[model samples]
Target: MESVVLDEIDLSLIHALTIDGRAPFSRIAAVLGVSDQTVARRYRRLRRADVIRVVGRLDARRLGHVVWALRLRVAPGSANAVARALAKRPDTSYVQLASGGTEVLCGTEASSEHDHAQLLEQLTETRPVLAISAQCVLHVFRGGPAAWPALTTALDPGQAARLDPYPGVAPSEVVLDDGDRALLDALSVDGRAAHATIAHATGWHESTVRRRIDALRSAGALFVDVDIDERLLGVHANTLLLMSVAPAALSSVGEALAEHEQVAFAGATTGATNLVASLMCADVYALYDYLTDRLAAIPAISSIETVPIVRTIKRGSIFGG
Candidate 1:
């Protein structure tokens, strides 16, 4: 596929959306000093090219669900099939073929111990499976509800401030009722879907829809994220780093890694390798530089395993039909 060339306006628009996925075209235009029609047209063209999308995702942890990162070493020649199957499952996201197409890495949400067990059983029974390691995410230093800084750097501070949404409310326990589910279902498909459209789908008034969405965001129960093809930004290497860090320095190392511009996601997890990070780099050489210079500078890292992702089948979870 031909890579889409993003101009300055396109980059700024993407950065604006990352700040507020549902920001009106007029508002984004004002920030970028472009006409509303131009902003809307560029967005449509990008969407049509499958270069970018906005999705609303629920933070399962707020609802008492466990999020897991799974690494499955499958039989040769089966990674693609396995990844596609995993991507089709609604619970899985960031499904990818990695480690020379013999391994599949994905993130899943399990609502209960039984659900987690059932997923493990299913994977163990699948013919292509060879080995599996499931790591529960203990804490997320970055990623998931956080925009990638590399992508968002196009906008100047003033422009970003204008586009920034209000701060989220304090974290609190959130329970999902049927109405919330319906509203989230519509958002999963299009985070920028109009409130009136969502209300019609959910059988609620537009005002109610707006109120519910605001409440969800403020409570940290939901977030709108930008999903973009990295190739559009000249990213050619996507690698996952699994590291064993000194127990005493884990927090510092994780925090430091989260600040790196090349890192798209970094988190502490429960497993042999306590810290995991996903990197988007310009090329393999860039990745090498990161490993040798940036990563090597961190004395806390004892060992590292680099898995170059071959492809990403899905970027985020989508709820409902």
Candidate 2:
């Protein structure tokens, strides 16, 4: 797919959403100082362009499912079909063809690496694929640098760069030696840096410069991404399906629901409600119909609590703990 580039106003609308998706068009209009109709027109355009999607964030770990990053090597001419197939799976969300050929980045609800492998095995029985590399996420960090700033911001020195470029992974930019530290401190305030500048200023061996950066990433700490526009906190309405289960069925059932893309956070808590989930989505109507039909297909559920999130106070340990 081609990239959708937004103009300045479009970017502003995104930032406003990052702050609060439910933000009324009247309110957004006030902030952006545009008429409500203008806001509406632009929003429709953004959606049509596919540059922004409002989605719900499910706490999968809480829900009893594991999330994984998938890299797939596909047969020639099969990338689109494979992606379309994976996209249909409730267990699979977020398929991207990355810089690598036929690579796909997806989030799933698998509690462990073994669980994901089993899922792949089951999937292969139906749709055979070439190769798959998977990474289990340890955590997801959220809410850093405030949208536009986050998009443009580099990691501040000594501060762990907020927002893991890779989900559930830590930033790699934090480990700067004294010399690298000095140079990075300069670049933190400014991204553009000349080689002589980094070298002369930091007093490091110039030959080892790029190597240091490689060490940071190879160590699993550093990543950089283009800044994201602020989220007004986009809305993906979710159904909270609750269950009555025998003690033995509690863990596995909760785990299964959590892996569903529409199911967000899942857990077995004390109450008439044995399980809970926060489903993430963009199209509320589809999600609503999906829950009533598809999730209802799962007999374990007896009750469901559906809610739409209005705002996020904070996200992840990415915030100062």
Best candidate, lDDT-wise? 1
Task: Give the alpha carbon lDDT tens digit for every residue of 38-149 in model 1.
Answer: 9999999899888888988887767888889999999999999999999888678579888577999989888788999999999999999999999988777778777777
Q: Positional deviation of 186 in candidate 2, in angstroms?
A: 46
What TM-score should be assigned to candidate 1?
A: 0.94
Among these predictions, the greatest TM-score belongs to: 1
Span of ten consecutive residues with least summed lDDT in model 1: 312-321
Off by over 4 Å in 1: 1-3, 317-321
The ten-residue window of minimal lDDT in model 2 covers 312-321
Clashes of 1: 0
> What are the Cα lDDT values of the candidates?
0.85, 0.48
The collision pairs in model 1 are: none
RMSD (Cα, Å) of model 2: 20.4
